[model samples]
Target chain A: MTPACVIDRAKLRVNAERLKTLCSQRGIQLRPHVKTLKSVQAAQLYAPPGSAITVSTLAEARYFAAAGYRDILYAVGVTPNKLPAINNLLGAGVALTVIVDSEAGAEHLIAFAQQFSSPLRVAIEIDVDDHRAGIRAQDPELIAVARKIDLQPGLQFYGVMAHAGASYGCFDISSRSAMAVQEARQTAEAARLLGEQGIPCELVSVGSTPTALVDIERPGITELRAGVYATFDCVMAGLGVCNYNDIAMSVLTSVIGHQVDKGWVLIDAGWMALSRDQGTGSHALDCGYGLVCDAKGRLLEGWYVAQTNQEHGIIAHRDGISPPSELFKYGTTLRILPVHACATGAQFEQYHVTDDNDCVSTVWPRVNGW
Target chain B: MTPACVIDRAKLRVNAERLKTLCSQRGIQLRPHVKTLKSVQAAQLYAPPGSAITVSTLAEARYFAAAGYRDILYAVGVTPNKLPAINNLLGAGVALTVIVDSEAGAEHLIAFAQQFSSPLRVAIEIDVDDHRAGIRAQDPELIAVARKIDLQPGLQFYGVMAHAGASYGCFDISSRSAMAVQEARQTAEAARLLGEQGIPCELVSVGSTPTALVDIERPGITELRAGVYATFDCVMAGLGVCNYNDIAMSVLTSVIGHQVDKGWVLIDAGWMALSRDQGTGSHALDCGYGLVCDAKGRLLEGWYVAQTNQEHGIIAHRDGISPPSELFKYGTTLRILPVHACATGAQFEQYHVTDDNDCVSTVWPRVNGW
Candidate 1:
């Protein structure tokens, strides 16, 4: 099988330990987002059973919950239709916390709370950098939403949380460190506002891979959340958050054919295997779809997957040099480091865990879809 | 649940019927590529059992073969490593046809064919428009590669096949029609070249969704191959190959929240649900990610999914108009017609086949990995 997802367990452990050490040094609980590698087996190394975890979908929450992860945070903003599933998780003795960033969102939860036998734990998502979803920390609606959830008989206002998603754009350490501090300050400010309004916030959460690894003290934040760091990608490397060697996951593909005159080496791994996440497209040194590597996980200098169709990837030199005949011989297996780990990892149903000897030590199955 | 892949059976049948009628009128076989909707159940409508079909991966070949599809064509260029899987299919009595475009590719097959008690069927891929993987139609190597496969005792020289992948770039009917003719002529030319060398070609295949839809007589082409036509997409609509109404597949998502100041409405369907294929980015009307539609699949003019994170899609108006609060109310389900149907379709494990009234009539499971 040429097009297979491979995970280097040695590199994965190193990446996982790096984050754990950073969070421990900062005296903050690390709630690893299992959304990257939605495998109970992979999570066992970092976010073991009984450890708090963050998930993007209810499916991951239920899956991890069944694996004995009691404290879970469904990071994505919750909708009314998903309430029954959340209630079901609560009924199963899982301390699941759902996030809301709008007053209308709170209203939906408030209306659906009546059917809940157990109170649904809710958190107000604060917009630290106006990145994606979340309400502004200074917005009056933030306090209104928190009050609504706290007043609802079937709801428990768990805390205030924020993700500095904009931190991903910071190319240098100083900027990322500043973004991490701002994320903590704004989220803590939201909690401070809630306290002034007689709403005590238990957990103040903030993070993103770049921010979490920034080595800055998140003053009021009790917990940190980051996903892609568990398996660093080209995007993280482009942002200077990690080195390319730290990337744990890659797509192992065999050289299928080549377009000699055009200097193209076609492989079996395409967007279907590498994912179409060109996360480093805007960077100074763009790693097209992914950075190309040897079968043994060694980086092939200046080579990357430039283009991809559904089932074909074109590997070309960044400098337009023709591919060497010996290296890209027919049936030669090559590893492609993904541009985005989470997106690429989601493409496969399982991960072939490789040991230091590049032997398949184990196969880890992962959950996909909602 | 929101963020599910939905297929309108009515539209799907109409699209299938359109292609079937065209192929029937032209007196050619239609070997529908099952890569878009990998479900054997879905293929039963367009490509039914006993009908020759094409697959992207060996997993799909084995899947459809188990469902009684005998004449399977492994379309992607075969590598030496996959020969065992190919042998397994042949051993199971599948009339599987593998393709090769280079001498090295043929050599790999020639060496591995000795292991098989039965001969391996091999086809020479003709590069019609220098689009992707294929030997140029008139290249001297085309005849050389054909002779090599024919001379090998363990291999049977099947025929010539070509795919007009460049036809996707043709934005008008006239241009696409011309590309279609060029595709047919070049592929047929390769078969004719093989015929002159005392090697009788068994098949002459040429197609692409745009090329297959062109109502032109493919003089020497024996069969037409297409995949996305079973469920047209925004890219097809952008190319004038099909209408948006003809797109049968969509990602059903609920409005999770809104960034009112930014005129953005966020949905649960992100790259994880609707893949990161921006195939229409170069078109006159770039459907960012995908075009928006109502829950019942009515096109919402000017609305498209502008950006996406892992599980969050930001739907915005092309004209920068604010979202109408009434229509985009919290938890209101909406449909998104994908930029590329095959890419979006692959993101899901199963399709929620919807009836005329927008109710799910059945669930069709699809094969994912190789």
Candidate 2:
């Protein structure tokens, strides 16, 4: 069927190995974020059973935990309401570490842990670049939050972690490398501050796809965590972190109709198949919704999905050239390289894993929703 | 748990009845498009079993058909690859009607139907506005496409249908009413053209949420179809098609953390919970991702989701005012009215149907994938 999520197994392995080699050379533990693919089968290739993994939702925590992943990190800032689910995961003998950036968050965790029997591992999120959530590394509040967790009988101060999400804005290698150093240094600084307070920080984690790929010395960081690296997207390609050929995931769509005069080719894949994350929209060469490709995953120059309705995608040439009749024949299947792999991958329940010959080798089911 | 899709059953019924009354007064059949909620249980309120309904995918067709919905319309342009699935649905005794906007599409359906024992009903999509996929109503190609289907022994020329998608661009009642008339008139013209060729037109369908709501005469239009009207969203509110209070769908999220210096209050609902559809970005009031509301669904004056990561949303006041500590206490659950109900609803596998008192009454599972 058309409008299906396709994963090139060969490219996926190459992408996964690239990150693994980078982390191995840097002498840092790689905690692959399973949030991108959210598939147990996909993780089998990179993050095998028992490998430390990062997840964005408790559902993923429970899923990966059930799949024998003992060490799991719930990367998102924890809320009081999700404590019950976390408690259940811990009760199941999973070493699930949760992150908090505020004293208020620590207070909630402390309160929830009062009723919990086992000690909950808590990590303080350090803000290296003021990118989304997290407390500033230099903020005295970082030590205060760590102390709050250490003081609680049912809580264990795990460490400090930071994500240089701003590195995504960096187009060149030098800037991204600098951001990577800043990410590692500040997160390590937070851990050092906690260490000075007699709270032994076991882990210091920092990463972003661009930052993690940079060959830079990260002195204090013990672990590197990054999602979307395993399935490089148009965003990563636009940022120069990876080439477009490295992108493993794409939406396979069939050309249904076209507006010949307007030079628009309509496909079945809309935001429903290809997500509305126009991550490369700010780049000099914006891949509208996604970059268009041939059925065999070869890019069609200048053609991108310009607009999308719920179930219809409009493919337009960047130069306003009409779609060639031979190339875009009715019912001809085409592939679309996603702007953000995580967002596009989340839109489907399963991925049709294709081998080197572009034949469906297997189907990988994804764990979606919280 | 927070970051869940919540639907107000009371408001949903009210919105459904409003359209039902309008269609009844105009003496037209109301074929509600189930693409918004995609839940059979949700459709039970607006469109019960035996009612004519429209679906975006074959999966939805099979889902609703399994739930006893016999009269289904696969509204998107039919492709050759989907013929097998459509055949299966027909084999299951579903009176499924497929649509085509081009002669190529009609040719594909005709050729695919050759291998089948039963006839396939096909509708000619008339373009009322140059918004999306459809053949122009006045174009001679429309008649040519209809004639091709009529001539095919295995295909039945169903009728003409048009969706005034550009009606969403109209922010006033008068303009929307005019678009509605144009939508109905143009679609009726296509059916009349088919009739002039000695081919009797059975159905004349036309609609869009904005156009469907207008109290106007649709002379030859036999049926009115709409999806988002059952759950008005920020886009509909921005267009003046419906009030914010009329909206039934929202994402319930808990305060996760905040960046106080930047006037950002982080919530658990990001683009993952409330989709990345910025349908109202061009409106006077741009609801970034969605408009914020109180836990009980009361619209907050100026707070809106300003930015989003995969699992984190940054809510900010429109006036750049810092988040008030009292209102945004840690773990305080809030609601977010979606920009596009259909997109937001598609994010979740099930919707939490709430009562007037804001208590969850039931859970309705949705049909998500294609």
Which predicted model would earn the best DockQ? 2
TM-score of chain B of each: 0.99, 0.99
Docking class of 1: high
lDDT of 2 by residue, A265-284 (tens): 99999999998888898998
Error of 2 at B302 (Å): 0.4
Across B288-350, the per-residue lDDT of candidate 2 in tens digits comes to 999999999999999999999999999999999989899898899999999999999999999
Can you write out model 1's per-residue Cα lDDT over B99-151, one digit (the tens) per residue? 99899999988888789768889998888898889998779999999999999
For model 2, state the Cα shift of residue B51 in Å.
Answer: 0.3
Segments in model 2 whose C-alpha atoms lie over 4 Å from true places: none
Each prediction's whole-model lDDT (CA): 0.92, 0.92
* Per-residue lDDT value at B107 in model 1: 90
Task: For candidate 2, give the lDDT of residue B330.
Answer: 82
Clashing pairs in 1: none
Candidate 1 displacement at residue A282 in angstroms: 0.3
Give per-residue lDDT, candidate 2, residue B189.
Answer: 86
Q: What is each candidate's DockQ, to 2 decimals?
A: 0.84, 0.86
